[model samples]
Target: MSEVRTIGILGGGQLGRMLSVAASRLGLRCHIYEPGANPPAAEVAHACTTASYEDEAALRAFARSVDVITYEFENIPTSALDLLEDLRPIRPGREALRVSQDRLTEKSFLRDLGLATAPFADVTDAASMTVALDGIGTPAILKTRRLGYDGKGQARLSTPADAEAARAAMNGAPAILEGFVDFSREISVIAARNADGDVACFDPGENLHDNGILRRTTVPAGIPGPMRMDAVLIASKILNALDYVGVLGVELFVTPGGLVVNEIAPRVHNSGHWTQNGCVVDQFEQHIRAVAGWPLGDGARHADVVMENLIGEDMERVPELARRPDTALHLYGKAETRAGRKMGHANIVTAKSS
Candidate 1:
């Protein structure tokens, strides 16, 4: 057994909540630092710090109280992390956060590493959009440079006439225009890298989306043999490039030509949530092992799985889902359910033939 240490998580959302539960199973305690009271993670953590990221005194206190630090989300302000890093070690480190924070920088960085990404150009104004459109053409996506997720902060331009509309919709934020990818399907690989330079990746999962939010994810993505290997290779490449020391989610588009990276999530991802029932070591537990200097777990799947997101009102079917023997229900303890909010998720597992 490895030495157990108290882990400090920077966010108090559902991801942090799940991570805290996983940490407890390994004899480690988790302290959640969040600005608001009653965050989901707070309920299960050893302690909770209610202070804004700008509170240097609180940040210092929180950092001093933990062995090592990690974050549940990537949108954390860089300055806040810098303050905590001064007091304790932050895994998956600042470089990964910086690169994943900005869409333009992320795409450029991936391209520089000889990775395939959709054709893209920077956009700060109408003229820049016009120029980018001229190069990348229409039917492209215009996305904000920072703080975009779950299909937010993005606009799709189907024609030249939509360029002005797209620019206006972004409200002058620095953005990127990406040429549309004609892909057959979308998939993601959830992988973990440890401080000792070890990496373990789960099987690729096929994904389906509705109105830009992920609706369902099925494992054994049903792609050709080479495509499965290609997906895992792409994810490993991103983890190695970042020198990442935690679980990372790599989203990919399976295009006619080949696999193309769409985005990177620096923490446990929604796509991998099915592992909770399908695999012995779920992404949450795997992440805790990586960040705590413990040996990484085997990521092999023992069952075929399908995970569905319960968006807002869809959570009403929880009672029904929970009654199914093969289904596992996970609900984020949120106060209210608004449209587009992820209220919970359900995973259906089926044992595979040996």
Candidate 2:
């Protein structure tokens, strides 16, 4: 309720770093609570606490230091939320996390909401896998129920013969079978809802992923006029369903029939990076504004923008990108480079078509 507020963020990655930067711009400060050493976000945050979420003392102290709390990533352990949520508010709240953290639950939640998603079935063991495979059929993907992202923890089944190998990939954890969908293109909507029930959605962005990690996002996604409106409405439906208070990322498949929900992220998403150059209010600042209880900003796009992620050795091209007048580079301050790592991104802006 004040001009100056403190926001505590969970997870210390690039999202946190950008969120902290936006918070600082708005005269708000950020405290980062991360268990990892040399976290990217810790470098830019006003304060950094390196402690395990299991430590109630550390969790409470982190909660006490900030006026409000949010997170850069999902996969936050339930135990940690149980400790901090009592002390301070968690924007987007636990309901969003609960549904998103588990693939099966998230799919069911979307289906129950009358949203279209890939056909899915639960699998906890070899027997269950057989049962699920029999029903959902071959050429499906087997994914762990929890904690899988960016091409990890997934097994592709081309035929029923590949079942055991797929089941073993779970490493004894619960899993789900999602029937493949033939989609024209993959797109995502990044939307924000503040505490006052106000909802604003950025223009949808078409996304391209390289080996499961997002490689690029382009605005004015090729979804025709009517489908784009449906995408926005689907995102808004989710935000309102959660009574969410912050930015949420909704990934969708533009299929022959309609838009099929892929998944939801309860924070600023990489797909929204194009907004930095396209919109008056970028996803990071929009998220910060919502978590800070401030009114939402303009989500209108002023330009056509394509955001390209620099994964690992792709950073080698930064110098070239920096020289381009229409390109804006946002590099994550990380010291090391390795394969599959997200090093930075570039936003290319152009005048909108008449």
Candidate 3:
């Protein structure tokens, strides 16, 4: 394979910004293609193409500028990908996106792999929802199959009678009804794979969420050693199944029965943010290495860390947080701060455990 000197990124969010930073560290340039002006990544990337995905000329130009293409998020329009995929390699591949972009498809894929997930059924309308509720029961979550994140595009059904309101919440989008799973806590494994089929998984991190947005992730998750292994194996399993390259984040629920699959992100994950301060190679760098055809780096944890997300009003605590020792703050260069917006994060190293 030819040497890769440039990477083309699909989205220009914080993940893209961090990926670009990591790429630069490795003597690589990143070109960010985003429709939104003043994206966070524009400040860090070597170049930014401000054009809609529908713009074929911009897409072709952007494709010609980079050696490999990767994305910060799923949900890139298929038409855009069809054009770009013909010009350059898209790491993690389209299958990963096809499997992860829809809730129902993701759940079904997990089940087919002999993995455990919450009982889920498809719901397109009132009729299908009634059947889904009948099987999944009440106290369930009705979520749109596509384009939902950070608690958006979801509604909770406390009881069967609340089905109407929950259905209405879907706004006519195809939905899935998931029966609640009894889990002790949420954890995630940030795993990476390269074209050579080698896989490396970081230590699992325990997560805490507020209003569907991740609030904190603590490394050295207070789980048994074996459970941690289980998380890693699960991540590795998915990585291999997809013939995946680059980094993938797998979220799981530690249930009394076993760890249950939650969802997968095909790029560097938020839960792995602590690695920035706690590991020799962070998720962003690992992803760049994998996609750039470099060997994977050691992701072994060298410290105990607590990563906290700075959302909206949390930005007010930045000055106080900066005063604390052993804390590293990574603020996204977002222009505006609004309710539920993720402004930045802090990784607090509690101890050097390695």
Q: What is the TM-score of each predicted model, taking all chains together?
A: 0.97, 0.98, 0.98
Across 1-354, the per-residue lDDT of candidate 1 in tens digits comes to: 555489999999899999999999999999999998789899899999999999989999999999999999898987888888888889888989999999988998899888899999999887887899999998899999999988889999999899988988899899999998899999999999999989999999999998889999998897988898888888888889999999999999998899999989899999999999888999999999999999999999999999999999997898899899999888889898988989889999887733
Query: Model 3, range 184-268, lDDT digits (tens) per residue?
Result: 9999999999999999999999999998899999999989999999999999999999999999999999999989999999999
lDDT per residue as tens, model 2, 131-172: 898888979999999999898999999999989999888898
What does each candidate score in C-alpha RMSD?
1.2, 1.0, 1.0
Q: What C-alpha lDDT do the candidate models reach, one value each?
A: 0.91, 0.93, 0.94
lDDT of 2 at 290: 95
Deviation (Å) of 7 in candidate 2? 0.2
Candidate 2 residue pairs that clash: none
Tell me the TM-score of model 1.
0.97
